[model samples]
Target: MCLLLLAGRADAAPIGYSITGGSVDIDVKLDGVVIGTSAGVALTGDSIMMDTAALTLNALRIEIAPTLISLSTHFGGFDEISVESAIIEGDITFANLWSQDTGTPGLFSVGAGPLLVTGSWGATDSTGINAGTSGQPITFPVPTITGIIDASPGLRIDSVTMHSIEGTPFGEAGKHLTIVASYSIETEVSIVPEPGTGLLVAMGLTALAWHRRSGSGAGPAPRG
Candidate 1:
């Protein structure tokens, strides 16, 4: 539980980031039965941090599997178990991130960037059978940075590199099944600031002091 609301006057600083040597590879399926041909997985937390309540629109998704072995006396007698598709990569570094001031004008603005992801997966069986198929689930989608940064006083994210792919097939085709997997991840970010160039430099210094006090006829002076 966390909450913060600042529409003006700055005061929203302190972000974070960290992740190192990520890894994942999975491809195993069962129920629409396919086993013993697809497996690769790795993850144990190298690094991860992005503060301010996950940067507003928070989100974090992580999944890892393996721990099912009930053969039922071999040969055409197995019931269910499944997994497929997963890959993650690592390397992340961000600090202070953004948001010093850039809120409410054309309607809200202030942000920092760098986060990319792409993922997918499906499989669940025990007698409740839930088949699976739809490769490509390793992740990448979140990247945007071109100036405009304050990053909340001081942020940090060190490393992250993950990879995952999954598949499985059993029953006549060289049967020898045994697989296990486990891993997890989820993150979100969004902070704002950067618009109209500080209200056009405060209206160009109040129109250049009203054109230098109306050309020094002296009806304006009074701004120390």
Candidate 2:
């Protein structure tokens, strides 16, 4: 019976967690000075999803500032720019969070890895530089941002921080773009039990019951 119980536990399936609530913070900087900042609650709404079983993310959205940012400095010989429809989409994977903590048994803390960010921007130009075509969207590759993950208290991924600097098409010689973002998410983790566990439990219980019934039915141990 004990062995059966252990086996059932050992064969437990990986958990699946869904994001319940979260917020996003972003900063857009040019030449080490903040030009624009965007902060808002994450619009999960069934669009943004995470799967632990496969270690994949689906349709994650990060919102940027809606207002247009007019830069005093010019990059790539462009000025008086209008930034629109700025958003990020990408995939992220983490170290095993399901395993027991190496330092402390029964405790789990999964570490994070670099975030590969890529997104689109609406193209609109009036004075100096034009980004992509007017009707078409401009797509750019962002640098891999270093990130940290915290799963305190349970299997839920509660907090994340990302910051990095990368070159931009708008940047001229010796100029760069800086991006910093952070996310705080609330999640609920539920386990998906393995199929064989129930069968094993039932078999163990049935064998135990049969043994007890046979013992109780003995007539005074056959009078010794």
Candidate 3:
């Protein structure tokens, strides 16, 4: 009976998670010269329950409120490059990568296979001449990102770090922009109990109550 109960518990559905709080670190450079920097923006997002045993990622989205960046520059007859209402988004794809026990029960580290991330940003010059989406949504090449899963006591993501470095074209020909971004997110999740599971729990409690009442109502046993 105990073994059967354990098996039933293991068959429960995957757990879902929500972004509690974290930080976003973004650095932009032109021709290898640091031009703009942003750190400490609040992050909010959600993730569908991923298979913990399989180490697979179904879907995850992280977003931040619009922020601004301005830099003094001489280009396109504009005195400065202004990026207003800039929002950053990060996404993850691929499945069934790697996982290992941290020598501690319910504490495991997992990674995504062929981890592909898509990011997007928008910017325009002061005159709005060099307008359009800032280049294109940067598609990160296959990179291995590691994160911790604290399953003991509860199922939760302690922290995860996503980092990438890539280059894209700039305004003038022959000039390029280097983007280095890192997002560190801390998350926690709650399990959504199935209806059947809840019903089963209620039934078990009722049975236990009946058994206790029956025992209490019984007359004292005769001396053996």
Candidate 4:
């Protein structure tokens, strides 16, 4: 016989978020993996949010890429700019409140790589010089995940990353800046069986076994 326990109360989960910025491009990595990127998107806003489904998640690693764009006029002789950034957020559910502390129920990390800048510029009559800058690498601190759990409740997380880039006019030396930002959120759930259900199943199996044993004994006595 097989016995099944009742479902236990759902425990609240923990959610967290992290943000980072760069001069030209931004890369958002979750749990040491890249999930998303944005180029020339603009960073005027303090934060941005992305759909969790857009990210690649299988057990742990997340992969992402940046969006691109083009410009009509060149600033400081630069024809175009590319910006990128990374952001991550999400929640983890627990079977029960005690389990959350006893076991590592929810935890996550965020990080950023060096900024990459690439563009072209032309010389003007006044300065007689046109120059462009290529992409460069940069690094930033990793983000940490933290949150509190609730009784039989779900957890929510929100995070955003921002980036910006600038180009200068050849002769005038005036610069134009481009910015981009992105964000995302994730949610996880856990389930457990209740004590009462387990006990009920155990009793049911025991009763069936006893009844079978008594019936077999009666048949043997009749045969004798």
Q: lDDT: which candidate is best?
A: 3
Q: Please count the clashing residue pairs in each candidate, in the order shown.
A: 79, 0, 0, 21
Please, what are the lDDT tens digits per residue for candidate 4 over residues 1-224?
Answer: 33322111111112222223222233433222343343433222222221112121211112234344343444445444443323222223211111123243332222222222222212222233544444433222223322232222222222323332233323334342423233232323322333355576667789779888988877545453
**Tens digits of per-residue lDDT for model 1, 48-97:** 32334224211222333322233333323334333343222222532324
| Prediction 3 TM-score vs. true | 0.53
What order do candidates take by lDDT, descending?
3, 2, 1, 4
- TM-score per candidate, chains pooled: 0.24, 0.49, 0.53, 0.29
Off by over 4 Å in 1: 1-115, 118-163, 167-193, 202-204, 211-215, 219-224
lDDT of each residue in 80-160, candidate 3, tens digit only: 322222333223445536777788766767665444444454555666665544544545454455556665322233222
Candidate with better TM-score, 1 vs 3: 3
The alpha-carbon lDDT assigned to residue 127 of candidate 4 equals 36
lDDT of each: 0.34, 0.44, 0.51, 0.31
lDDT (Cα, 0-100) at 168 in candidate 1: 30
The list of candidate 3 runs beyond 4 A from truth reads 2-8, 11-13, 29-34, 48-59, 70-93, 101-108, 113-120, 126-144, 149-171, 192-224
Report the lDDT of model 2 for residue 144. 33
Q: How close is candidate 2 to the true structure, as a TM-score?
A: 0.49
Error of 2 at 140 (Å): 9.6
lDDT measured at residue 199 in model 4 versus the true structure, 0 to 100: 70
In model 3, what are the clashing residue pairs, if there are any?
none
Model 2 lDDT per residue over 1-224, tens place: 65566565644444444455665655556767766555653434222333333333322444434333444555455433333444544445423323233354333334332233443333234563465433224344433322222343122332232323334544554777554455555555544444576676677788888888999987665544
> Ten-residue segment with the worst summed lDDT in candidate 3?
153-162
Ten contiguous residues with the weakest lDDT in model 2: 152-161
